[model samples]
Target: MTITIDTTRCIGCGMCAYAAPQVFRVVGKYSTVISQPEGRRDPKVSNAENGCPVNAISVTR
Candidate 1:
C-alpha cells in the first residue's frame, strides 16, 4: 500500500500524525507523509485517512 496526502485539501489538523505517527507528520500548515507504506496494513493509517476532514489522504495498493 501507498499513502499520499493532498496538501491543497489538507487543513493541517494533525490527525494523521496523531493516528499514525510512523507514517505522517504535521509540518507548518500541512500534513506530510514521512515514510512510504512498506507493504504493511495499519489500522491507524486507515483511521487517519478516514479521519481527515477534507479527505486529503489517499491509500493505493
Candidate 2:
C-alpha cells in the first residue's frame, strides 16, 4: 500500500501527524506522508486519512 498527501488540499492542520506520526509530518505549510504503511490496510494510515479535514490524504494499493 501507498499513502500520499495532496499538499494543494492540505491546510497544515497537523492532524495527520498527530494521528500517525510514523507515517506523516507537517512540512512547511502542508502535511506530508513521511513513511510507507505496513500494508494497504494499516489502521494508523487509515486513521490519518480519515482525520484529514480537507480530505487531502490518499491510500492506494
Best by lDDT: 1
lDDT of each: 0.92, 0.86
Question: Which pairs of residues collide in model 2?
Answer: none
Segments in model 2 whose C-alpha atoms lie over 4 Å from true places = none
TM-score of each: 0.92, 0.90
Write the residue-wise lDDT of candidate 2 on 1-61 in tens digits: 9888887899999998998898888989998878786744878788888888899999988
* Residues 1-61 of candidate 1: C-alpha lDDT, one tens digit per residue: 9899999899999989999999999999999999986767789999998999999999987
Q: lDDT of model 1 at residue 50?
A: 90
Please list all clashing residue pairs in model 1, or write none if there are none: none
Model 2 lDDT on a 0 to 1 scale: 0.86
Query: Model 1: how large is the Cα RMSD against the reference?
Result: 0.9
